[model samples]
Target: MLVGAASMIDSVRTWLRPDPIAERQVDPVGFAGTATVAATDYFAWDQEDKPSRTTALDRIAEPGADIDGWNGAGKQRVDGVAVLDVNRFARELAVVTVQVHVIPFTKPAAPSQPGGLKASWTALPARWLTAAIPVRSLPGGRFALSGRPALVGQGHSADLGNDAATEPPDADFSADTTVVVSKLLTAYGTGDLEFVRAAGAGFLGLDGAAELAELDEWRVAPKADNSGVRIGTATVRWRLPGDATLACTYRIAISDRDGIWLLSAITVDAGGPR
Candidate 1:
């Protein structure tokens, strides 16, 4: 009788225990893509195609959400949309910030008298706008807008502060590093892989994608944080077929084996000359 009572008690406990809720997984890239598409559709309209716009909103957003209340007076066009930031609040919810390049235009106002003004569109300048969109995840890899997007101000640029030093070339190995950089760039200009392999050793170059017109400026700095690795920055001008020139800045890594300098890697640094 005691064994029976104990078994009943255990069964009751098991049946009464609550099941744990599994957290939903969020895909940042996929969510960004969805947000971009939704933003594009939200801004695109011809006024005549009202049905299409309504259908698009219905597919992406919930019912009765007034995403865009354009009184059919103005037309908005989207030039581009990019994901600026993604902040996930919970496993199933997030707020994605996006930059939208849009062109807004409206029809001219009717004149007080007939034939006073022509029926032409007064187009405003193209500009960028920031938006914060609340999104929620659903079952089977689907997403929905929890609310309408709110237009916000521009995003702030990063400030590294004034005390940051632009690492200058090391005096001792500057000349030697310059020689290695010149050789690699010369070979890279003509798409000469064999010469680059011999000069840079393990470095793979641009495969002659650009014609190097001039090596404008270069600076070498031994990495203060890492020994045997020196950082180099160079501004190179490229010659286009129609006599056009494009100047680009590149950052390169050089390995110092005793005194021999070898190119380790090279890449374009952001905010460098366009």
Candidate 2:
């Protein structure tokens, strides 16, 4: 009777347990269009008149697949698709999670106590590959790998960076540059010289308000260096009202001045301030 009861309890527990694999998604467009590698060849994927993200991913999974059909496909705007590579993608996330080095239940910055940043990779591959996807909608967004991560501290030849050097530092720095440039441009457009001078003290090179006011429009063209220190470009339509747009490249340098990442300097590259 004891053995039978135990058997019954085990059967009920098995039925009550949830499946291991889980559903996840990422925006492929976000991956390819900015700060990340192309989930798949965008040009080739857009071949379908009305391209489907899943179809594109399926084709990408094929080896040396002829993707010519996707060529010359018109502009594509993809969003809100799920990524289904459970084993690999989740493994990446797990790596990211372990990399945090903070105790899961404690404050992130608190020092490690005893056993810290524990991880087990034993079941990850099976979890990713064997996972079931009940809903088949909008898949293949995972391939949109984020920009080359500064994946330091992972047994690599460099203890130079901090442990909390999470995956998105490069992405964060790049985004910050865009914001600064935009702020400066807005001040220039609105003839707010006082604001410009104050904000651009460490950055912009302007002769005077009158010269800045000449900029009819300013825009941060998406072209930028993908490296850790992003050097970005902005198009300044000089002599505003009607002037050629000058491609201006600004070097964004981050410094640990006073132990904080103040935007140390935003100097123009050689022949940069046109």
Candidate 3:
């Protein structure tokens, strides 16, 4: 009877135990577009052939600025400039309201987590607006792909030594380069596991030579009741310093008879100079 009771108790414990979900690190990929301004001759006034007459016809050249499109299309013209006078030739002007979009992939929750997922958008300001040319010019140049925002929080992880036995230093989590995170998210959606791994390893400064462990513990809490597990759907806002990258790790956990098992770890790369 004692043996039977023990068996029953084990069964009950097993039933209450939660299973360990798969664990893997996710890395983000990056994509960027620069706003450009070009000089286009919309309408040119022909020079009047008649010479001596004291009064020449009032000719005008309407020069327009074209900003490259953001989502795959023709360049867009700068607004508020029409009918430029001949006297104003080679004059300078400023364009305002240039916009760009940075999108990231949707993250998935570990199987062990509970509650529905949630996701939202977060924005980090650019360290400095990288205008192709000084804002003084009418047709401004394109913003270059250089200049990253400062990193916030801790910096990147340190490298491990040649021997596999030694552990690597912890990653610098304070660096806040926005570009890193944006790039990471892009890679995640495309299923570029290599890129994801590289980003994670670089940001964390883990043993590059060593293999990364899969996600171990998964847990989820609902924003409200009745909501299912929804980790990927939720969004978290973060900031970084000038041209620096930010890295953060989150864990997932599950309950078991013995205790709790780790399921996965998520690393985020964020903030960089433009």
Per-residue lDDT of model 2, residues 175-236, tens digit only: 55555555555454344435334322333233221133222222222323443232332333
Model 1 residue 221 lDDT score: 66
lDDT of each: 0.58, 0.28, 0.22
Residue-level lDDT of model 3, residues 188-235, one tens digit each, is 323343534332232221221112222222223322233221121112
For candidate 3, the TM-score is 0.15
* TM value for model 2: 0.22
TM-score of each: 0.43, 0.22, 0.15
Cα error, candidate 1, residue 221 (Å)? 57
Candidates 1 and 3 compared: the better one by lDDT is: 1
lDDT, candidate 1, 11-63, per-residue tens: 89766873334334557776687789888887566554578777887888744
What's every prediction's RMSD, in angstroms? 15.2, 23.4, 29.2
Pull out the clashing pairs in model 1.
169-220
| Top TM-score prediction, candidate number | 1
Off by over 4 Å in 2: 16-38, 41-274
Q: Determine which window of 10 residues in candidate 1 has minimal summed lDDT.
A: 156-165
Can you list the residue pairs that collide in candidate 2? 25-83, 36-147, 39-144, 47-70, 86-128, 87-128, 216-240
- Choose 1 or 2, whichever is better by lDDT: 1
